[model samples]
Target: TDKPAHARTSNLNEELGQVDTILSDKTGTLTCNSMEFIKCSVGGTAYGRGITEVERALARRKESTLPQKLGADYARLSGEKTFVKGFNFKDERIMDGNWVNEPRANVIQKFLQLLAICHTALPEIDEETGNISYEAESPDEAAFVIAAREFGFEFYERTQTSISLREFDPTSAKKVERSYQLLDVLEFNSTRKRMSVIVRDAKGKLLLLCKGADRLVNLNIMSAHAYNSDLFSLLPRHFISCPFSLEMKSAAIKAFKTSVAQQITDAKALLTSSSETPETLALIIDGKSLTYALEDDVKDLFLELAIGCASVICCRSSPKQKAQVTQMVKVKTGSTTLAVGDGANDVGMIQEADIGIGISGVEGMQAVMSSDIAIAQFRYLERLLLVHGHWCYRRISSMICYFFYKNIVFGFTLFFFEMYASFSGQAVYNDWFLSLYNVFFTSLPVIALGVFDQDVSSRYCLKFSLLYQEGVQNVLFSWVRIFGWVFNGLLSSVIIFFFCVGAMDHQAFRNSGEVVGLEILGATMYTCVVWVVNCQMALSISYFTYIQHLFIWGSIVLWYLFLMAYGAINPTISTTAFQVFIEACAPAPSFWMLTLLALGTSLLPYFVFASIQMRFFPMYHQMIQWIKADGQSNDPEYCQVVRQRSLRHTTVGYTARFEASKHFEEFSEIKSH
Candidate 1:
């Protein structure tokens, strides 16, 4: 199979098939990090009805409708808007229009003002066109500044002590100038979801402006309550239950019910209210709350709120917290975890995960260096995990099983031959032939199988992501299956040895003189071992392509050639011995008859087992378990049946969950339907 263009590492490819949980960073990885201020919240109302360039393009193609649905404000911002490259502000409601006549114009003005004053973006004006751009540490900060510029509050200059903005004043119906002394900037970080700036206006009024994800604000409120240990202790137990529990206890429990209901009502009121707090307020939270939420006592409550709330965002989370969260999910669920990001901050979580994916994006190469796999974009992760991941897991597992089987069959044949010789410890075949058997004859076929064999097509793998759960659940490779292969190898060895010995010991070889008889017996037994080992290609379920077939059959041809060469080169025996060996190894009627008998005796048991499995047990996995007696206890048949039923039920449940995964839907167009 061809590797995807985005993938960087093949070393951990198989890990993709086993991922049960994915922890992803929001910026750069999920959002492209090329921020465009497409929308904003003002006076408890979201304004600015536009989406980003990528979103618009995706929407236009109908490849993804999610971005379009997300831009629900599109209708309001659709008319007569000024166009900006890379920023899709095509709505007239919030672009280039005089703010004097707009509804809630005061709130809109304050919102624009907030965007302009935010930290870290510095303006750069083109000498020829007079168009302004921003230079900032974070793209998101630049986006906010750009949005403010397009909305008529242009942040044009900043110095060590002050900031200046050109604004459209509604009262005067004219552009006005404003300057503020820079008081302080509270920068954004993982733990602090929001950033705040304190500025002294021309009038010397000290004002603090803040913005961030809503979840951050909600967590802050919880943290404030948690800070007061007395108040938190008074609250009912049901609200802050176990970390894993999502269910809320009965409302009949008055203390818990009242507290939760009141908090919900207060949150709703704050979100719905039109008035700005002190000036114009956007409902938001800060990182202090997140820090508090991470503590043992309050972590469960935080998780409850975080999971239950649909639009909550954890702002300003520290990289340590990110890794901790991933580790927590892995420990709680006992599932494989995958973490993806593109920045240095993301390295911790990426390393903590079972499989880490890093985007080689604008953030830097730190994350990519730490990750198991690297990709150009987050979207490519779909094909990487679904198609390539499945192929690697299946191929590698089958290769290992077959490797063990081949070695056991060859090794145990020697063991049986030793027993036949009454433990004299003499070699059955030449040392050179025995050494070359695995390296030259058997190696290429299994290598080809591991690299090229596919039980299901890439299309099918993508369509049924539920199949990936097999790797995570360890359905194919287990102790039982390994032991089962060993048992089969032993059985085949017994059949091959007995059949070959029986034929060689008959009157034909015995009637010859002692020396010639021993030589013929050795040659006949060696042929039986070679033929039995080669017959494994027939029983294997791996897909055999042109290369695989060439290698498998080519090995048999090479073995025959080696035998002819060995007869001519050996100095220990005379010409007559060589002639006798040739006669025994010839493709004569009796030689072929003995070969067929050996093959049939060695393979018949497996053929019958395979037929029964195919006919009665259509499920390949169940057939494997039945062969191995997996999951059975030292109990009655009824108990074993009950255990098997339970196992089946669990598998069905995991399959259903995997089929319904949102990540699968996001990547697989076929599964989406």
Candidate 2:
């Protein structure tokens, strides 16, 4: 009976929430996984917000209270708030910096056609279903074509006779009749990283424009023109170094190579038209690099500012960089973490997380099956902390404190009586009665507390308070409360013991027995024994709000009622160990008031613990105190804000997720065997 009750709790995730550090992935985790080509910069004039732009515009409708959303390329686009100084996007007309070009209005039609007709994957449309399935190897390539259709531009069909051909000129030209010419085509290869085509007009005039890896494209044009390689210089570093890849990393590499092989063909004597022998030009296209150049230019400020910009590190990155970015967050922050992802690339980072939550209804099947806690709504993220995360910590700590208080009352009397029986020939209560009370009352309430656990998110969210760690301090004092209870019970029991002994004249009932006392005094000792056994049963309800609040209170009550109605208040149990029977009536009325005062004194520990918490942990205590506050009060709005803000950070840590995921992985490891 002196042993403490066992604790039942959610895995210790709440502790992790107290940690100050948190790491997160960038791709899909920070940046949306869906990438779109909304803007392309030429000269200094920039275009498009990209797909992220469209999303921000849409999200603004929901969060209109916040500052206006800004574009990522705003540094180069906005002329007024520009940070580029002399380096503007559109300053000296089309070739100058400091302006934004409306690509959506002008050559967008041609741009769509180029992305679609020149691309490999054909959009699958169901005639009977009227459903169009646009399957592409790469999401970026697929996104471009979708935007094209969304804008009412279709990839147009072209015929050989419709347009005349022209050769490469120094400047780029839009898609037009003169755009197609019997010009040389530089094949696109994955290894080469670019694609190009040249054309010559009737007058033998040449023009060229190429799109591919910025470095390779610039190199080839400069090689042909014998122009300064400055434009081709550092092209990869500045324009293409941003990591990417959502899925199909290796397939993308293969697709890059296959597309190039399709373009190679021989040329005839006139060297014009697809009908002419394409053998010479096609032969060595796979490994060809028409021109090459290298340069080093670093963005000194960008690297420093990148600390705040949420840039991702993508070591061994795929076409998508989400996992690599997640890895970077772990190394940098060094804290237990939770990652929510729904993609194959997320698998590496998901497994790496302290809590990995894979969304079932979004993206891929692999991620859903990999997560620890799969919920329908990501917004539950807030509630999860409120209930199962940090709030769980608060509750567990409170319960432990409550148990300590109960321990005090238990220890003083249980030990005192046990010691008395062993040393002084005084066994007050029958051991059988003591065992019955322990079984019925002591454990039921604690077990019920564990079984009926519920979510508490709606109840609390607290900001960091001056008394943030009051829960821990309260736990230490709670033990003191329990001791106070035990001391009071011991004091009460001792009074009864001595009073019965002094008043009685001993009369031995058996040759081996020395009784509690002789005659009526012995009768008083018997009454005291019955009262103390029942007191222990009643006191178990201390932590509960009311008797009914305890899950097993009814069961404890039934046991007590059974004892009062049928059990004889005697030490001997030959035939009446549990059979309720009335003892002979008392010689005098019981001193009920004395027992009440003594029991109440034992509850002094509860008053002390509450007072300390009320004084020191005023924020939380005040919250409990204001449980009666109504909305009609003058401070309704202010109180609501205070309450809501309090819960924002008070989450039970993701400890359950960490442990569950760990065990799951270990289980899977064994199963894989």
Candidate 3:
């Protein structure tokens, strides 16, 4: 909660509510913006305390054949109280020099040594506590270094030409300090997809250590196909339980020297040769492949396949590619898209989206500066979209509809009166009342409703995330709903005018013992209009706060007070309204009866319609409210029950897309939901 949601536009809530798709950056946008060394594989053997999704699937597959469990059966060492902050590995075979007993101990030592010295991270030592903390350009580098330190290969110092490390020597079974003469440090980039360091050990042994995307790392040592197959086997078996039937394809271009035109042709061929059901294809391609995939000739086909899949992973993409993907989804799907990011690279995509959510993270403020909405973390996006967004859309829509209804109710009364008066242009309300109708009498209450109205509690909104579909469907502000309100307003105008004129036509004022004249008739009709419209506002409000009550009731009181004050003025200035309320309208029995009659008659139809709708054919929001009032919303299975009862109206292909950011130094994936 340290970071609150910040909005740039007043209508951002409405936009957020209608968002059918979201395109987000991975690193600081989806993750906790931090990294931990969770699992690792070496020499075809997995070493980690955690039972990962991959291991769980393997365990299930080998359950019948194997006598013991697959993952948890592997012994894990207990963590000490003073454990490394970023290191989480706990496999007994790899902790506390135990790797010396393994057959591949020499290879494991090389791997651990490589992890310790391979990054652009600088260690920050606290002066008082003397604890080492790494300040790195990326989370992955810091994670690797910390994991290496926890594995008994501590990189203690670094100089311009050499690096020092305190490592475990299996020969003497002791920690030995050593330094390696540095040769060169090759930094990583989007194109190379890898970073490597060369060094000369004490025995004049020159060695190279590199880490990067699978394609690049495997290219130097083994055939890409064999390396990829082995690496793929170590991945989590996510496709086994996928909801959609996806034909996963990996188009990591084998050569980079191909011309743009040829690359475009290749990409088009890949798209065309895809499963006939391109809708079920999940593409895993590198940046170079994406270059041709996004070319004008192939973009359409690429979008067709990408938009349909649950995920399209574009590994090692640049900022331009991210923006291109966002624009493609927006233009092709014609759906509202929200882009989220936390770095400079994401600025383009964030600005290109319908709504941009920038995360204030370790990366920087460029994304936040360009965003329409700024938030601290990705988790808050749920409340921002589902709760606040729904509330704003509901409020604005109702306020607009009410505006139409009240204006019609007030304006059309004069139209009806003109017909009765034979087109004489006789005014139905006082001049002051007409002048102040929108400014005072009907303004504040609607403002209150517009700013504060909420149909359901925020908790209920979050609990039933599906309720947000109402806004996406434009249920509240639909053309049909608008016209229905207009028709209701017209109907109310008829009842107020005809009933007022008819009742007053043959009636006599009790105080004066005379038939009601034009002045009294006009004043009485004005009274009905004010009460009816204000009372309509009261009925429309669902969640009433003290401010709402003040505005609604205060509006009515202010109108009466204005009348009495204006009546007290001299007839020269007040004109028609001079003493009208005091002598002619206030004490007249027929005026009071007609005012009450018109008010009740005008509201009765609306009340009945609303009651019937709420009782028999309630909308989704109404049902949610009813459940909340009945205390059924707290049930954990409430959403399932609603689904089973056919309350949900499902719509598919409403995507929420996300990309990977720079600081992650990990794979970037584009997922659609």
Tell me the whole-model lDDT of each prediction, alpha carbons only: 0.61, 0.38, 0.71
In candidate 3, what are the lDDT values of residues 413-467, reduced to their tens digit?
A: 8988888889997786778878999999889999999888989898778666667
Taking all chains together, each candidate's TM-score versus the true structure is 0.72, 0.50, 0.81
In candidate 1, position 141 carries an lDDT of: 73
Which of the predicted structures, 1 or 2, would earn the higher TM-score when compared with the native? Answer: 1
- Off by more than 4 A, model 3: 53-76, 79-82, 159-162, 169-177, 180-184, 198-208, 221-289, 306-316, 422-426, 506-518, 629-651, 654-673
lDDT of 1 by residue, 373-480 (tens): 887766676667667877788777777888888888888878888998898997766666677878988888888887888766665454334445567666667787
Candidate 2 per-residue C-alpha lDDT over 511-583 given as tens digits, one digit per residue, 9 for 90 to 100: 3454423223323443443444344434432234453354344654564465555454443542333332233
Candidate with maximal lDDT: 3
Candidate 2 ranges with C-alpha deviation above 4 Å: 1-21, 26-45, 48-114, 117-122, 129-131, 135-142, 150-336, 404-408, 422-439, 447-556, 564-581, 584-595, 615-621, 624-673
Instruction: Please give the lDDT score for candidate 3.
Output: 0.71
